[model samples]
Target chain A: MDQRKDDANWSPPRQHLEIGDSPADFNTGRVQGRRLTGPQQGFGQLWQKTYKVAIPNRTPEQIIATWKAEYGRFWPSNSRFYAPVTGIKPGEVGLIKSNQGPVPLSTGVLVLYSDDTSFSYMTPEGHPFAGFITFSAYEDEAAGTIAQVQLLIRTNDPLYEAGMIAFGSRAENKMWEHTLRSLADYLGSSAPVDTSIVRVDRKRLWKNFRNIRYNGALPWVRKVRSS
Target chain B: MPESRIAMSVRAPKDTVRVIDIAGELTAFGEGVLTEAYEDADRPGVKSVLLNFEKLDYMNSGGIGLLVTTLIRAQRKGQSLGAYGLSDHYREIFSLTRLDEAIGIYDDEASALATT
Candidate 1:
């Protein structure tokens, strides 16, 4: 009772949003994104995390033809294209770009796997790249501008998995210093890469999501591999 | 760390050339290995340079960018740049970044040198 009275006198932190001030931007998604995996679906419908691939200033149209023409020949065995992506329908590959908040995938080969086995092949380093942002929309739901992009990769991104398991642990240091720098550059982080070795684990990834998820700015993150 | 490292081989007039390989993760020192190999080019008049990556694992973006920078410098001095022995993953990064498109890449060092 005494603690409750003390709490009433104090104001909430400015950085943290209260329930009333919460913006309509937070979202949670799984692999394949909110995209429909098949043509038919109902209450039991399955959705996959979808991402839009974009490169700063490199328009999709200009690079699409050359991408398919040059590297299309190297698509994986089960995959129609080496760069697995999703949009449109099967047997089609093109550069997709939408300014709308509905997706994050832009200009890579959209892969449609017969089974989910592709996850095993995806390297941890192959986390989605390009400049696209993410957002969510569903039946009877209003879409809002996003501050973070939470997602799940369908493939087994080894480093991503290990990094999570080894979060705050020794594996963080095993990475090249340049990776941190590259991410810093990618995220426009002012902090230098290798600022300090992180010591964390599964508990850390879930508990302290605020810091790990885009340094408390953009919530865009692929939370886990399995989820 | 990848269990294996890329092997180095030379195929110019065998008597006139030496090669040092940069394979697996291109660490800070990996960059040095590459620079030294070229700087310490044994034969002053060596006509070709081979960056053999066979059994190679991966090259970080810095390494990729380094390759690009090196390609330009090598060409300026009339030396041909050859990159071979890329794994599927590295090959993807190279192709996606258009590094493969920008530079000449062969499947093997022998092919690279023989052509030169």
Candidate 2:
């Protein structure tokens, strides 16, 4: 859409996930938007739904297969991987087996992978894309294997900062968070991998952004604009 | 101290340049910088802009918007703009956002200065 028109309506989402160290019923003040200050001095543990994704169903093989087939389409080619095998036999036989592609791209904007690892990447312009951390389950000598994927996201829309974050007002942060949560909900527990968002230290994240350090924990973060 | 800081540095080459050290999580800060920078630039037609992203670690979609806005503005004013350093993950973000299609990126201080 046009710039002004896009910016005119729709503020950031302000919904909050059930995160807080309180009695599960404590308000903890406003959940979405900025001013998400916490544990409220003694609010217990202050938590935001930074990453709480419910992975979809299916198997790891199936999920990886789908990603290899089309996940690259939504993103650039850099997000893909390949596994190849080549060997020489005893006397005069040679065998070569190799597979390469995206690890089963999700049916939504979220990215997916089957390996027991995660990655990080950025836009050439500096915008961070939603990256993810992966967890894998293997059964019986590798015959049965399962995979879980998680994504970390933040709202990109400018209207929901709500004065919580320094950039866009809380309103923008609120809307963006809501949109992302909605996207996460839509992806649900239908795919082979489970995805979630986790809040990392912002300062640490910045350090990581500059290539000076990495937390080695959180995977990816993204900006979501309301459609 | 709101967020962890990165290692990239945006320094002044001639001491005549004015820089803005933006802090906060970029997911939302991107919009804030765009709004304020556009309003503050020398009334359209000024050159030589440097964004000290040393404090920015993670930039979401809003961060992309903020950079895009800055790039476009600079292009209009015949300015030289270059982002010197970014976290390894942010590099992928550049590719994801396709900012390479719009502006230029440098690896460190000297290159950013030389390009401009």
Candidates' interface RMSDs, in order?
Answer: 24.1, 16.9
- What lDDT is reached at residue A81 by model 2? 21
Tens-digit per-residue lDDT, A68-172, candidate 2: 333233222222221111111011111111111111111111121112122111101111222222222222233233332222332212211111245332332
lDDT at B50, model 1: 68
TM-score of 2: 0.32
TM-score for the first chain in candidate 2 comes to: 0.26
A99 Cα displacement, candidate 2 (Å): 36
Worst 10 residues of 1 chain A by lDDT: A114-123
Q: What's the number of clashes in each of the models?
A: 30, 67
Residue A37, model 2: lDDT of 12
**Candidate 1 structure quality by residue, lDDT tens digits, A96-182:** 221222123222222221111011011111222211111111111122111111122221122323333444122212322333233
Best by TM-score: 1
